[model samples]
Target: MKLYIAEKPSLGRAIAAALPQPQKNQKTHIELANGDVVSWCIGHILAQADPEDYDAELKKWRMENLPIVPEQWQLKPITRTRAQLTVLRKLVKQADEIIHAGDPDREGQLLVDEVIDYFKLSKTKKNNIKRLLISDLNLPAVKRALSSLKANSDFMPLSISALARSRADWLYGINLTRAYTLQGQKTGYHSVLSVGRVQTPLLGLVVRREQEIAAFVSKPYYQVQAHIALTSAEKVAFTAKWQPSENCLPYCDEEGRVLVKALAENVVQRIANQPALVSHIDSTEKQQAAPLPFNLSQLQISAAKQFSMNAKLVLDVCQALYEKHKLITYPRSDCRYLPKEQLKQAKGIINTLANSSLPCNKPAQGADTSLVSKAWNDKQITAHHAIIPTEKSPENSSLNTFEKNIYLLIVRQYLLQFYPAYIYQQTKVHLLIAGGQFLSQAKMEKQLGWQVLFPKSKKAKTVNNSNQKQHESEQEKTLPPLTKGQTLHCQQGELIAKQTSPPQSFTDASLLAAMTGISRYVSDPAIKKVLKETDGLGTDATRAGIIDLLFKRDFLQRQGKAITATEVGVALINALPEMATLPDMTAQWEATLTAISEKKANYLSFMQPLTAIVTEMVQGASQQSFSGLPQVAFKPKRRKKTFTKKVARKTG
Candidate 1:
């Protein structure tokens, strides 16, 4: 019988039931009529041993043997699930072929592969098994995968990547933890010092943001506003403003506050400055096409903004929709489009979902799959298409608020791909001040096009008032039909003072935005250009986890819907080396890993550099530089002698 291993018992049971009427459990393993024997693992049934496991002496803190770099890592049957392992061993031994039917992701791949490698499963030519990967743990996809089973070697690259990532993490995590723990003990610290490659960098991200907030100094600026009566014939009513002189735009005093009084001092400057008059009036019509489909990053961002849901929550909702409800495509996908042949399936999915509780508001009749050209590129899809609803009616109608929003978001965006481009006209009017050195004007907008699709985007999303006003202005304006070159009389005008503000610290959303351009900060234009040509900092699948790592370690905190860093986080990262300071660590890793994925770079090339750098970082952080914070001192210390106690002893 062909052997099938699923990630968990629930999924295994689901797969088994989907097969042709299963025979009663006969022997050691559960057998199915399709000639498939299904078994499962509970997370990790085997893993590498701890440093202390290697030797009894290794358990003690010893700085001399800090870096416990194992020549070849070893694994043992997980103690907690030894009973399940016995069942798995019996099943694999009797099976003719084995199918790695785990969750379709890196962790899943690694976990399943680890089991096969652990027990030395049959590697004979008699075995013709392969991985069965599909978005949801449903019947149709599972049966389809079974009918088309290929050899396991076909997915060697994916298997290799999974192994590498896990091993790399192990190497770094183990050594650093041991090193830091020993270092702490030496400094009279009794607690564990946890260090991880991803965790450290993630903490650094939060810490950097904290520093920006802590050091921020707000500067104020003044504007000269005049209430003016629109001409009688025009019968217009609006406020007017004197163009702040280039020099006096932000008339700052020594303390750097905006000089509101300075504007009053310059009355002559106001009369001479005059109000900004409309010099040019231009109007045109334009349309904004619907946005591209939901890549994981895009989905996370939209969900976060719309429902205050984190990436992990959105991912959880997607998993439920895919696995439990069986009404959505893969959730952890990087691609937002499908291949040409996938159009049929797309139509079917839409039709299927239309009947689901997650029904579409509009008719799905005119969904010309061809019209979604921007989203339809075969080359972009590797593992799965965007997270679209599946053919099955959702069994998850009672989804939480975040889950519902994410599901609705994916559905709306996917449906919009077929919707016709929104049509509208836009208008802009600029007025030139009567007396100013060509620097002041008034402007307005006429029409809103596809902006209607996204009310949030159409409105200014920022908290800043001036920016909000600017967006509101260009979005819509009622201008009395004034032709170009119409000189308007200004009854009143005044000069205003303004000052430039320092850039604001990046928010989590903005941080993700910045990470999209890791190459932007590079000094060498050539390198920067190459980074531009490359993908964003981390893949859609990894960035969310990266941010999660930051939050888990107390580095990042959610303070009233805003992400900020803790003091310990700041101190820890501030002590890091220059290389660790750069967020491009994620990008660089991805670039090299992508090359490895493409076979352009050797595995050693990527591994050696990271290994060397991490070694150096561990050594560097070992030194003490903390202040007003808790840190494990990485060195032994002499016992302190209290002066008061010593004096009492001497007197006695």
Candidate 2:
């Protein structure tokens, strides 16, 4: 019988439902009418060989042996997952043909590959064998994939890359954790000290910010403002604000009030004589495109900002949408655009969710146009397009508040493609008053277009808006009629006091943003152009997890959504060479991997260097002395978080 191995049980069940085979029975196994027996993995049934797996003596953690690199790696059942392994063993023993079905991304590839390694399936499968790569489990996609299944050999390099990364992480995660934990034990703190390549680097960013905050010395600065009446207003209105041309003034300190008044009177004499003139009128309109589809990083950022949703929660909900509801495409996609072929499904996708979609604040632009965006490239779209709804009505009521928000964000963008681009007019006018210049700025929308998709954010920015002061919409900054040479009456107004503000601290939302777009950060012209053309080191699926891992390990701490580094994180970053923490290291690694992916470079050649470097990291980490470990003492926020995700319902 043909044995079909699916990534998970739910997927296996779906595959069986689509096949002609009836029940081929085993514990948690099902058979279809076509005699294809299908079984699934609960994520992973096998894992990388740990040092403990080598022998009983190796199980004990000791520094005497230093780096424990196994000459030949062993495979074993995941202890917590052996229940599923038993079922897999029964099927693997009897099947004539084995179909390798797993998730399409790197992680998915790794998981399925591990199971096959555990059973040594590749060496035995010399007959009719195939592996299906699929992004989603919809019937059409599954059928299409089955008809085109390639031999397991087709993905050997990808499998090699996956295994290499896992082994590397094992060497890194196990060695570093043990070494660091032992050091903490030596120092009298029994806390489990964990360190990782990405985790430590991420923590360093937070700790650095925290240190900056702790070391900050507040400096007070002075500024001036004035109140003035414009045109024919009977009463003086609005705060006419400007700094003196001299840029300095004297202030009374305690008993110096009289001394200050004497200086102020002289300065007031000079201020009263000068005329304020409108020097220039300048206004321009810009179309702020709706953000790209929700990449994992983008989703994390939006969830944190819009619903105060945690990164982990967003991933969980998305997994549900993909696995349980089967209502959306892949959950952990890095790309925000669909492959060109999927563009044809646009009409069906729009119709399926016609009822579930909400009105966008601004109408979407460009969906109907034949003109396509670079985001929609076919070759770049490896497994799937950006996360989108399946071609069926989403069971809207079944969705929770936050899921609803995310799904709507997807729909809004998809629909937006059909709309026109945002159009607006900008106007700037400057006038002259007395001897000084006054300016005005305004924006008027010619058409809302796709701007409607990302509605005016409901999250309000708190400001002191009193009726006594005109409450101007942030969108509307109106200016009075004025010309470049326009003149205004010179009127003396009160000088107002303001202080210079410190640079804002990084928020989780902002930190993710700061991490993207390497081209913006690179100073060298050549480097910037190169980065602009390539995908950065970490994929969308991995970056947030890397950041979250840092927080979980106490390398980073969150105070309300703001991330800060702990002392340990800061020290670790400083301890490592500067290149270790820079994203370029990851970029460099990815560049080589891409070369392997394209057959331009051999996988072993690319990995051989990493193995040597990792060997040093593994062997050397245990002996390296650390001065101290950082402890995080943070108070959690008390306010209840607001959320906007709604559970997506399954359509019958």
Candidate 3:
């Protein structure tokens, strides 16, 4: 019999619907008319065995067993899914042919492959296994995937890469968590001080920001603004900012902020009531394209900023839209670019959106189908394309308020690809007043274009450097027509005193943004380049979960939308080594994983060094003292035990 193994029950049902008719659905497997059967796994049926599984002596946490490296890694069936696994074992033995159906990403590949490995099929049956990759659960998309199947062996490297990642995480997380928790106990802190490859670095980001804010010293700075009246028919008046000359470097701060009030006063005294000559006028038209469609990270950031929704909520809403409602494509996609071939579906999807009762219906109807934005590029496609709306209309779907908001966000971003670029004219006027330089700038919108679809309140606000705040204010004012050599009277010179502000606390939106663009946080150019290439510290699928895990562990706390590290979190970071708290090591590991996926690097080369690093870290942690950490009473919860009485069976 031919067998098809799917990643989940919904996927299994979808696959069955696309097959021949006269299908019989059973609890564990579906039987087709032609002696073919379809089965599935519930996420991952198998999990990595614990350290104690290797040896009984390692059951208790001790510094002597610092780094537990298994010579032969083992897999144990998850208790919750063992029944389904039993059914699969029966089916695998009876099947003459097998098809491996899993999600296209690394985790999905590894989960299904792990089950296949557990069964230990013959070499020929393993070689004969086919692989089915499905990103969209829509009927048409599923049917297309069924027509073309690739050899499962072709994806072995992907499976291996995932295996390497899981093993590395286990080795690193388990060893460090045990080592640190034991050490923390030495100082009367009974909490389980967990450490992870990604979560620790993420917690470090928050803790370091808190430290920086605590250590900040506010200093006063001086600024000079020029109020000038134009010599035109309208007599338009505008504010211009003082531009200090190179000779004033001694009196200025590193960011060019005037530190000496006396020097700023001299400029204010010289420029007042003087005739200012327009030395330079620059006017240039600029066009800004609409932002690319939503990747998981970008979508989370947007939802968090606009609706104050947390990252986990956004991900849950997206999953519902994709799997349950069938209104959108894959939600865990990291790619923001769509395949060129998929662009042909734009008209159908747009029409569906226009006909629906969504908030963006009008804009969807007005979208130009002929105009294709730069988002459609095949070369940029990753494991999956950008999250976009399917041809399915959402009007019939019973969506909740959160689902509707997230769905509309995805649809609007996709529709933006068919809109015109936002056009604006930038005007800059350089004035010379009493031997001092003053500059005025303005931005005039020539065309709103795609910008009209987004409300100004929903737009992301840019935070300017403290030194450039005055200059930014000038750019917001309107400017009149002016030419070189034209003379205008400066009404007055104003000297404003301002104090530098400390960095703002991290909000959900800003924290997710930091994770997505972590390269900006690092100082080393080499590490920054690696991080940029690897797309930061965590995958799009796992970032939300990692952040959520921190909160559940009481390592992070949220105060009205702002996320801050808890005392336990800060103490843990203080106790850990510098390398464990930074993102540089995690970024390098990601690059190596990518190389392994591409078959350019092997698993041993990556694991050996990781093992060595873990060994050194465990050794160092053993010698470290946690006496300085804050003492918090933590009682670990004990699982309730259930006892069942056994009935003796009668011998017949």
Candidate 4:
């Protein structure tokens, strides 16, 4: 009998439904018409054993047992999942063939592979294990995956990569945590001092940003503004900003803001009540494509901004939509581009939305399907495409408020692909007044196009905040048709003083972007280039959890949406060595891990460097001093005194 083991029940049901006439059995397993059995795992049935599991003596924190590297890693069944493991063990023992149908990511591969390894190592080795890789959990996707089952051995490299990551994290977290805690104890401080591969580096980002903000000193700047009355056929007035002159370069910075108050006042006096000439008038038409679909990080950023939701909450919502409602494709995708082949299914998916309960009306429905942006390139697609709606129409689906909002966001992006580019005409006028040059600008919308879909949200997913500022600045009061050498009267001029502000604290939106593209924060050019080749800090699936873990450990605190490192967090960072806090370590590890996943490198090749790094860290930590850390009142339990004091009491 053939047995299919899925990562979760929702996926198992989807796969079973794709088969012909699958029936529900007594133990909740699905019996296929072809006499196959389908079972599911909640996630991981078995996990890496904790330190105490290896040796009871290791339970007590000690400096001598600093680097707790496990010679032979062991696995134990999770308490709540043991019953499910027993069922799977029985099914695995009887099956002639086993099919592994986990999620199509590194963690997913490990989840199923570990369960099989548990029984295989203890019992008999089987050569009949097959693997199914599916990006979506819908029926058609399931059927497509089932038709091309690969030998389980083919994905052993991914499993190895996942195992290496787990073991490496275990070694680093276990050893460093104990080393720090024991050191802290000597200084009369007692806190867990929890640390991890990704969480520590992430906390370092927050601490550094906070330090930068705290050390920043604001400086005053000035700009001269002019209100000019156009000498046109009709009465017209507009505002213009004074431009930098040759002598003003020392007192002025980019964006034409002058640092000297006297210079700005002089410019205003010179330009005030003077006749102005239109030295140049330029207008250029531009086109902007709609936003690309959401990868997990982008979606998390948007959700955080629009709904004030955290990254983990956004991931949960997207997961529900994908696994339970079957409304969207996979949620843990890193690619923001879709496969070219998926363009064929775009019409059907859109047609369903057009006819479904979504608020899309005639104009959105009339979007032209022939002109999707270059985001349809197949080569850009990673393990999965961007999150988009499945063919399953959510007409009567029971969706909560959060789900509906996120679903609408996805649908809006998908509909935008079919719409024409947003078109506008940008106008800039350069005016010469007295002794200074002034400039005015305006943007006239030629067509709303795809902008109509996300009427209030961002037009492009990857457009940075700097680009957004430029787009906002391009839009101003409509400029009257003017030609070169046209004369205008300066109605008024004033010196507006402003202060240069420090960088703002990170919200979830900015933090997620930074984590996704962390190379921006690194100072080393070689490491920056290396980090860019490998996507930033942590995988999309793991970054949210890393951030969440920091909060749980009191390493970070949130006020409204702004995140800041706690006192303990900053001190903890100072307590550790540079190797523990720098992004280069994780970045290099990720690059090597990628090589391992692609079969370019083996586990030993990848681990040798990490082993050295860990050893160096342990050696350095032994000599490091920690003091005045946030104190924890740790009172060791008093042992019972079993001396014979009874005889003394009787004599008294």
Candidate 5:
């Protein structure tokens, strides 16, 4: 009998629907007409055994058993899914052929492959196993994936990489958590000090930001603005900001903000009613293409910003849209570009959207399907393409408020690829007044184009210009026609006093953005490059969970829209080593894992150093004193018991 093993039940049903009909649906397996059976796992049916599973002595948390490295790692069936495993075991033994169907990502590959390994199949049987990779649950997409099956052995490296990551995390997390929890107990803080490869570094980000905010001291700065009136027929007026010359260096701060009130006042007095010459004028027309389609991280950040939704909540909504509603493709995709071959589906998808009652229906109808944006590059495709709407219409999907909002967001982003670029003109005017340099800038929208799709309330006021100085103010205005050497009258100079503001606390949007772009936080160029190449500290599939873990562990707390580290969190970060708290180590591990997946690096080379690092960390932690940490009351968890009722009246 031919057997098909899927990653989950929903996927199993999807695979069965694409196969030959006349199938009998049983509780555990589906039997096809041709003696073929399809079975599935519930996420991971097997997990790495805990430290205590290796030895009884390690059951109790103690510093003496600090580094628990297992010589032969063991896998135990998760209690909740043992029944599913039993059914799979029976099917595996009866099958003559097997097909491994899993999600096309690393974790998905390992989840199914590990189950196959647990069955202890013969070498020939293992070699004969076929792999099915499915990203979209739509029938056409599933059928296409079914026709392109490859040998499961070809992905052994990917499985191996995942295995290494799992084991490494276990070793690092279990050892450090035990060690730190023990040390924290010495300070009367009895709560478990959980440390993870990603979560700890993420918590560190919040703690450090809190520290900076606490230590910040505001300082006053002064600026000089000249209210200038054009001497032309139009009689247009605009505000020009003072640009300090080399002579004003002594009175200016590092950011060119004048520190001395007297200096600013003198400039204001001198420039008052002065004749200003328009020495130079720069006018340039710029076109901005629509942003690429939603990657998971980008989508999460957008949802967090626009709707105040948490990262986990956004991911859940995307999953519902993809799996339940069949309205979107993969939700956990890291790639923001679509495959060129998929471009043919644009017209169908756009038509479906236009016919639907979505808020973006008008934009979809107006979209030029022939105009392909830069988002359709095959070379940039990763494990999965960008998250995009499928050809399926959402008219009868019965989506909730969150689901509909996120679906519309994804559809709008995809439709933007077929819209024209937003065109605008930027004008910069350099002026001279009383031997001082003044600057004025304005931006005029030449064409709304794709920008018209966004509501006026949601539109950004200004575009980011990296070259623009901090003191420069950009306004939306239409400057009167003027040439070089033209004179304008400075009606008056105003002195604006401002205080330097501390960095804003991280909101859900900014926090996710930080995780996605963690390279910007590092100082070392090598580490920065690695982080950028690896796409930051954690994968899109795992980042939300890591952030959620921190909150559950009391390492992070939410203050309205901002996320801050708790007292325990700050103390834990202070107690941990710098390497554990920073993202550099995680970036390096990610690089090594990527190399392992590419077959350029081996498991031993990565694990040996990791084990050594864990050993050193354990040894170092054993000697450290955590007495300075705040005391936390240990709350023991209460386990609920279930009672079975018996018929007492049976004897009567």
Candidate 6:
């Protein structure tokens, strides 16, 4: 009997349904009329054994076994899902051939592969094992995948990388958490102080941003504006603001916030009521391409920014859309570009949208199918394509408010690819007034294009108003036809005083963006370069969880829409070593992990350096003396009990 093992029951059922007229066998396993078996793992059935599993003495938190590296790594069944593991093992024992039908990512690869290793199936029954890779759980996608089963050994690199990541996290997080918690205990603090590879670094970002905001002192500045009126043949006048030239320095700061009120008053007095000549008027047509489709991180950030939904919730909704509703493709994709082969599927998807009663706003119902965009390059496609709607139409589908909003977001982005680029005419006018250079700029929308699908809300408009006010001289207005040397009246001049604000506190959107583009945060040029080559802080599949972990750990607190680091969080960063909290160590590991994925490095090669670093961190942490241990005098809040034994999930 052929057995198909999937990551989860939903995926298992989807696979079973897609198989050719498969018959349900006791609902435990689906059997093809020709004798086949289908079963699933409830995520991970077997996880890397915890330190407690290594020995009884290790169970009690002790600093003596500071750096516990398992000489022989152990795998044990997750207690909650041991029954599922039992059922899977039984099927594995009976099946003539086994198919590894897990998720398409590294973790997914490890989920089933680890099960095989747990049962000692690979060493004994290697010849009959095969791998299946599928992005979407849709019937057609599953069918397409069934036709292309690869050898199980082919994904060994992915398995190796996943195992390496888990083990490394175990070495660093297990050892360091014990070391730090014991040290804190010495200082009368009793808390399970966690440490992790990506979680600590993420917390550091929030803490540093909060520090900047707290330490910031606003400085006052001033800018001179000359409001000018221009005339056309129709006797109608268009208003324009005079922009200051480069010489307006000493009067302004680096951000162009005018710093000297006296200098601004002098300029306003000198230029007020002066005849302003249109020295140069230039108009250029510009086109802005539609945004690329939603990768998981991009979608998370967008959902957070637009709707104030947290990253974890957005991911949950997207996953529901992919797994439950079946209205969208894969949700955890890292790639924002579609494969060229998927271009054929785009038209059908567009037609489906056009026919369906979309969940988008009323104005977005009419999607333009004629706008073929530039996001269909195969070369840019990664492991999976961007998150998009499946061929299945969501018309008349049952969706709650959140699901509706997320679905609409994905649909709108997908449909936008077919819309024309946002076209506009940019008008730049350089003016001469009383021996001072002033500039005026304006944009006239030629075509709304894809932008029509996503109209900015009032809040967004208010936020953009600052940008508009920043370029005070370039007001958005219709420019009347004017030639060189044409004189215009400067109706009024005013010196406006403004204060320079500190960097804004991170929202889920901004923080996720920082995590994704972490190279910008790294001060080390060499490390930054490597981080750029590898995915930052955490993988796309893991970033949302990392952010969620911070909230759970009380490292970050949400104030309205902004995220601020807690005092405990800041104290933690101060207490920890830079090697543990900084992005450099994790970045180097990510680089080596990528090398492992690309076959440039083996598990031993990657783990050797990582193991050494973990040893060094544990030693440093053990010997180092911390001041006061950042005692937050409050009882730990009661929440859902979180499992900490898993190496894959940790928050430092």
Per-candidate RMSD vs. true structure?
8.2, 8.5, 5.4, 7.3, 5.9, 3.6
lDDT of model 6 at position 473: 32
- Cand. 2 Cα-lDDT: 0.59
Q: Give the TM-score of candidate 5.
A: 0.94
lDDT of each residue in 1-652, candidate 1, tens digit only? 7777888775676677667784556333467777778788987787665555567666554656655655666777767788888888877777777888776665566678888888875567224657777665567656665676666666555566655555566656656555654554554554444455455655665566566667777654555544333453443345444444556546655543346665544543454324445676666655556666787777887777667777766777777776666656777776777666556667776666555554453435435555655677888775567766656655445677666677778877777777666544444555554453222223332333223345555443322234777546544444456666765545454545555554555555655655555675566665677677565665666677667766765667777677777765665556445555564564566666656654567667777787776677677766744343465443332211121111111100
**Which pairs clash in the backbone of model 6?**
222-258, 243-439, 371-418
Cα displacement (Å) at residue 544, model 2: 4.7
- lDDT (tens digit, per residue) of candidate 4 on 164-254: 8877776777677667766767777665676667788888888888999999998899988898886434343778888888888888777
Clashes of 3: 0
Local error of candidate 3 at 621, Å?
A: 0.6
Looking at model 2, residue 486 earns an lDDT score of 51
Q: What is residue 264's positional error in candidate 1, in angstroms? A: 11
C-alpha-based local distance difference test score of model 3 = 0.84
Please report the TM-score between candidate 6 and the true structure: 0.90
| Counted clashes in each candidate structure | 10, 62, 0, 0, 0, 3
Q: Please, what is the whole-model Cα lDDT of each candidate in the order they appear?
A: 0.60, 0.59, 0.84, 0.79, 0.84, 0.77
Q: What is the lDDT of residue 518 in candidate 1?
A: 63
Put down candidate 5 lDDT per residue, 81-109, tens digits, no spaces: 99999999999999998999987778888
- Candidate closer to the true structure by lDDT (higher is better), 3 or 4: 3
If both were scored by TM-score, which would come out higher, candidate 3 or candidate 6? 3
Off by over 4 Å in 2: 55-57, 86-97, 117-131, 144-157, 221-285, 356-375, 428-440, 457-474, 480-497, 500-508, 514-538, 547-558, 564-602, 611-652
Which lDDT value does model 5 have at 375?
Answer: 97
lDDT by residue for model 6 (1-652), tens: 8999999988999888888774865555666787888898989788778766778777766667778888999988889889888888898888888899888878888889889878886564776689987787878878888998999788888889988888888788778777887777677666767789889988888888888988999999776777786532223254444455678766666766667777778878987667778898899997878888988998888888679898899989988898998998888888888887777676677777767766453433455555567888888764578899888878767988889889888887788787777777778888888888787777676787777776543312322344755333333356777788898877667778778889999998999988888899899999888888777778888888888888887888989888998877877788888777777778778878878876889999888888888788877875656664666453342210133475444423
TM-score of each: 0.80, 0.76, 0.94, 0.89, 0.94, 0.90
